[model samples]
Target: MRIGIRPARVVALLVLVIVIPLSVTSVAGRFMGDRVYLLNSTPCRVVVMEQHDGHEANPGETVLIKSGFVDRTPTMMVFSGSAFWFGGLHFTTDTLQVRDQADIAIPPSWLSSSIMGKELTYELTADGQLLVKGPTMQPSMPQPKGLPLKARATPDSKQCRRG
Candidate 1:
């Protein structure tokens, strides 16, 4: 007695095996959101640039982020004037989440350098790795003397209401 296998059956079975897993993975990625959360623990204020996607791609703008003290949203991106540091990297389908947690401490040096008004990009991996496209060169500006804004007392109360 001899046994033989059919070529059509073998081809069909191979297709099923290959196609099923790929279909499942693509669907899962869409629903998973692929979210990454950035929690800030430092006391100093940080700035970040964020890409605003709408019908068309728009130039990202700088966002002023405040320090999170056990309460507040964590900054997803830190803008060093020219360069920006993002919390994570992923495809456009992925979601980026920024939250405030008192436990996560970012290195002071990471936020102190400027990119010389040139655009630079950096990302923090999900596994806690930092990657930079280029070396950070410029130093942060010196703090101003005295208060940032000096307020003077109004001589007359009516002057305060003037536009």
Candidate 2:
């Protein structure tokens, strides 16, 4: 007796062997990609600093994150404190300033992180705690001066009044 293999059966078996393993690997890869493993990591606290009346004060804002394994970037929207203190015409206005940087750093506690063109420092302790320092406040820029416009009497207006 002689036996022969069908081409259609061989192709189907090849497809099954290749596609099933690929599908399984892809599913496993997705789960692995979702998880981030950092070296010797635990829960940590983050603090942001603020200034008031030439003195530093705690804004009481805190963020808890995993140490050595945070990935984040920030776009900042701030009010530009521009003011021109003149007599009577006190021109004080708040301008919206936004800065977008495509280059974002990884993780919130990855030692050094850069956000909104400002470099932030992160310190991790052995006791599973973290501290993050924000950028210093800069001085405000000089505001625009409001100038008085002198109005002149037009000769045409006087002639039109007669008509």
Model 1 is weakest, by summed lDDT over 10 consecutive residues, at 146-155
In candidate 1, which residue ranges exceed 4 Å CA deviation?
1-5, 36-163
Q: Global lDDT of each model?
A: 0.30, 0.26
lDDT (C-alpha) at residue 52 in model 1:
40
Q: Estimate, for each residue in 3-72, the C-alpha lDDT of model 2 and write its tens digit.
A: 3457777888988999888877655542332222112121212122112111111223222211122233
Worst 10 residues of 2 by lDDT: 84-93
- Candidate with top TM-score is 1
Task: Name the lDDT value of residue 43 in candidate 1.
Answer: 23
User: Candidate 2, residue 10: CA error in Å?
Assistant: 1.7
Q: Where does model 2 exceed 4 Å of error?
A: 1-5, 34-100, 108-163
Model 1, range 56-134, lDDT digits (tens) per residue? 1112222222221112233334422233333332211111222331233233333423232112223332222233222
List the candidates' TM-scores in order.
0.23, 0.22
TM-score of predicted model 2?
0.22
